[model samples]
Target: MIIVNGDIVAQGSQFGLKDVEVVTATVDLEEVRSYRAAISRGLQAATSDARYQRIQTPFELAPEDDDADIEKRPTLPMQPRMHPVEEEIALSGGCYLWDYLRRSGTAGYLVPLSGGIDSCATAVIVYSMCRIVMDAVEEENQQVIEDVKRLCQYSQGVLPKTPQELCNQIFTTIYMGMKKQSSRDTRQRAKELAEAIGSHHVNLDIDEVYEAQKKLVVNTLNFEPRFEVEGGSNQENLTLQCLQARIRMVTAYEFGQILPTARGRPGGGSLLVLGSANVGESLRGYLTKYDCSSADINPIGSIDKADLKRFIAWAEKEFDLPCLHEFLTAVPTAELEPITENYVQSDEADMGMTYEELTTFGRLRKLNKLGPFAMFQRLVHDWSIDRKHVEGDTAPHYTPAQVAEKVKRFFHFYAINRHKMTTLTPALHCNDYSPDDNRFDLRPFLYPNFWKSWSFKRIDMELKKIEKKRASKGK
Candidate 1:
């Protein structure tokens, strides 16, 4: 007797049913060419939008065009100073933390300074708050206050040390991404900012650890339409995961271990003073879920990226840190990977787009005015459907209700993976809004499901039209 085994799964979903000609027939040479062209157009549009979103320049200004005359134009006072009351409130969070640390009998803050805008701002705030605590303790324990003051004086050199430490770990990454592209000397600039802030500096070389952790992190991502590292492979997924894990581990090491030892304490305070803003929530989420996960307090949690930049500029004038200008001069990057290496593979050498392409489409849909979040959920819904279509198990469409079920399943899969962020603390919990600190609340899951339902309602109508066409053709 002969028996057939169904257990032998093929390496790729698209390649599994090689005997099915229809599945293979989707990619004609012309179709591939058009798809590539559409991708190029889409990329151009998205990047153009991002560039316009960044600058003091108008949307009409060409990115490469010289506007020397515009540079000479008198800069208006775009940001007004905060009211005295508002300023007092603005400075209160740091004060609150300083008192918390003092009462707890902790030695001092162990800041994992990255020397980026957020971390730079954080280190300065911590330094200022310590000063306040020293003042409070001045009359009671002059010796301890003086010790704290002397420590702060020694640590004043640390501000510049933050950038240097960051450089030691990812200087090659910064060079490839920033140095090669522009004449703007970012390292010198970051160094200058560090000096202006009067903080002690230390350089740590974490390259080997980062590389080793990258592999471990990649291996942990079990769910996927996965890719193998190969010739001309962009390694984007690896790059992103590596970047996230490195940030998480580096912050954890600096705060959880080194800081306590440095301060001669068992552990640190309840609040870690995260410097995140709201505008870059998506980017922040990507970075925070990785690097900034170790924080207990996020001072700017409510501020948007736009408002945060405004506040930084305001601080530059108020604090007299000329390095603030230089700090602002450097382009913002998470320092996750080299720029020459495509963060997401733009090459369309294959018939089907890579996983990066799918994710980009999903992300772009979420950002576009046509309803970015809804579009993102819809695309994810379609990825599974497209996979099924390509397998020839189903025609290229599903009912509205069916699509909703698939979206729900996709999210359900991710929810099981929520254990990924469970170890980290969330930054803030607003009275109206839940803290984004990944505290594993039931709410975040609820919105994705709602969006998924909306997506099915919108797309199923179109899919039904496609389905009917196939049904009629069977005659």
Candidate 2:
């Protein structure tokens, strides 16, 4: 007997097939029997192969153990195991880029490789997508093969042999350097990583473009914006930095739209721009709006700083890209400011909190649902260090007052920059505490930048109580 399966319920409910007349059809019983017999023979041969026997590991009979021996055997409960977060993030981000490219029929990905941990992580994810496509082709995944062929515009039956070759076809890395904005070390690192990952690397200086923009702005405003080092006002300093960042975005899209045609490809398709902003920076509102935050997609948008560093370390070994080792130990910087001899701006310094603290703050704010006052109340103990009386001197690492101030500052910035989240590029939702507005997080964009009236009163009362308790203890 032969059995056939169909969506009978869907046909009856939606198409009124239930009212239609039932028809019977004759089948070729002899052909069906022959097909079954052939399938059985194939299964028998596959199971009987010596290679199958060597590969399979069946349980032994346990040497006919006695009842007492069986009772004495330890019973271990089954434990649930999850894939590593590193693997999950990498695979998800890689597949996201691949699907986006295939679905949109885009040429490839264009990443502004800044040599920072975030951008490096983005580049690695693109490389991972190349590896995934190559693996799929190896496994004879027809859909993947066809998508890749169409994406690269390869003729029929012409398949890529290696991940590197496929990556060269699909990925382009650009390093945009302005005058004195990017360091030699960072540029070298970007070049080395792109080479190691087999991406098409383009190094261009945007000094002229920046100068032209600056001149236009000066001509319009009758003043040239200067950096803080040159004794510019805070507004001027920020304006100058933002100009550089925005200029880079304009330049990136210009290249992304034309790089494929520039490389002599037949069809002119634009590359999808990839953003590299991490969750911690986004939470703290440290990123410039529409700068690096603006892109087609952000692979590491929901990822925290610590996890990104861990991912870089893992990628160094897994992808066999040793150039990622530099970012592992290198201090994270935006490099938007001039590299002066006296003052060098770091990401942490500008954010007023370490990445570790930022990670904690982000988790508390989103995962734990803690407001500013609540967060301050919790972090007082989390950040506090026990002070032992050593030679009659006691010094706490972080006092409650200090913790409260940090919490307040964090929330203030978070509220003010909550508007930026509305424009954030679609990010891979791998994190538990994502602040993505489109899906995971839904919060008001316009915030007062301060606590509500009642919340402020409560926080003030709490702070006063803590101070009183501290004063009594000190006495």
Candidate 3:
């Protein structure tokens, strides 16, 4: 909803009729039209009552509201509001990852392209850095250029206009393919962007990789004893199946080694894990235990979803790249699932809470405010914590016994799939807080530890007593 200064205007009001007492000025044209449309559709949803109704003033001489300002106001600040120290630390950590890969004699950064803002930003950053590295190499070694030119020819199976042209073609094809927008426009734009930046992009049909990897994981899960036939385990087992396929540490390891030892150095390329605040936190626990967050490097770990979108906008305009809008507007999904429905945060049938909710409970447990069972259910119930639970009515309460049983159920469901969070190389941590780092280790010892505590028994007994009393009251 748009508000001007102190007055409400343009959007949010659903009723066609405007109240005059609260609104001092005439109803704005946009607001009138929007309200009219809403009323016509018979879906008038008012956010506030008369007490908070906004009054508008005459603004005949006012300048038109700034479109850029409107776009930035609520969204831009969330990005890496990094203090100089924080940025220095983040950049230093990125450099460390690059350096480590270089010393290891690896090549190519492998990032999963989601059409969402995070992946787009990551791609832009990787493309930007790859160009810089190539330029520095070209200045010192003429043969370096020749080798890249030849590699480009071999990879492309066609002659490129220039060394940079080959690089652009490769990057563009790969970028578009990864994002799942293999349309002619996206391909042409990616090529254009790559040419402008002088970077080599390779298209490796990530969908094919996702498919092969997904099948392998599913087959492995189907063999697991714990995943055997059960009533409620169907969805749980499917989620675990995803965990195995999603944990492509081996794939990442190979991609990490793709850069030739003689070409540009390792770590010079980075696998930017495009993650968000929620996923980063949930990953702190054992779910998807080996995938998504398990990356050799994470550039946007500190950036929130809203901020990431803003950065993408900045990058699009600064680089004169196409798809800035398209990338931002695209659905958020890693395409790691076999089914089309398994894509995006809002994919309702995806089944289960996100990594963030699990992480929140883990955090609560770490702080010792509540036991794992209690925290787990609370985490499940806290609609704000998990997007899946958000649309439901108020969450129900669970006693210690109920929570204990639920914990056991969840653990049994998740343990076999813990491989989802595993990774190849440990991440470079700027400090102790990073759960995205490959070095971070979490154990399920907490669940058992809490289960054995006296609190668990006491809660179970109390729940039984309450049940008995309620049953007897019928007499």
lDDT of 1 by residue, 53-140 (tens): 5456455423334344455432222232344422432355455555445455434444444445655555555544534443445434
Model 3: per-residue lDDT, tens digit, 1-475?
3443334443332211112213233234555456666665344335434353568987654246643354433221112223343234323433443344345433334554434455455556555444433554545444434444444433433444443553443333134243332343444544444445555444444456644655775598764322213332666555644544354444444453453332443324433233322223333333244454556456655443444555667657755666566766654444333333332223212424333334433345444456544654454344322234445555444443454455443344334433444442243334333344332556642233434556556555655775586568651
Between candidates 1 and 2, which one is better according to lDDT? 2
What is the descending TM-score order? 2, 1, 3
How high a TM-score does candidate 2 get?
0.79
| Cα-based lDDT for every prediction | 0.41, 0.79, 0.44
**Residue 460 Cα positional deviation in candidate 1, in Å, after optimal superposition:** 9.9
The digit string of per-residue lDDT tens for model 2 on 206-304 reads 999888888997899898888999888989889888888898899889999998888877787899999999988887789888886799988999999
TM-scores, all candidates, are: 0.46, 0.79, 0.43
> Which window of 10 residues has the lowest lDDT sum in candidate 2?
8-17
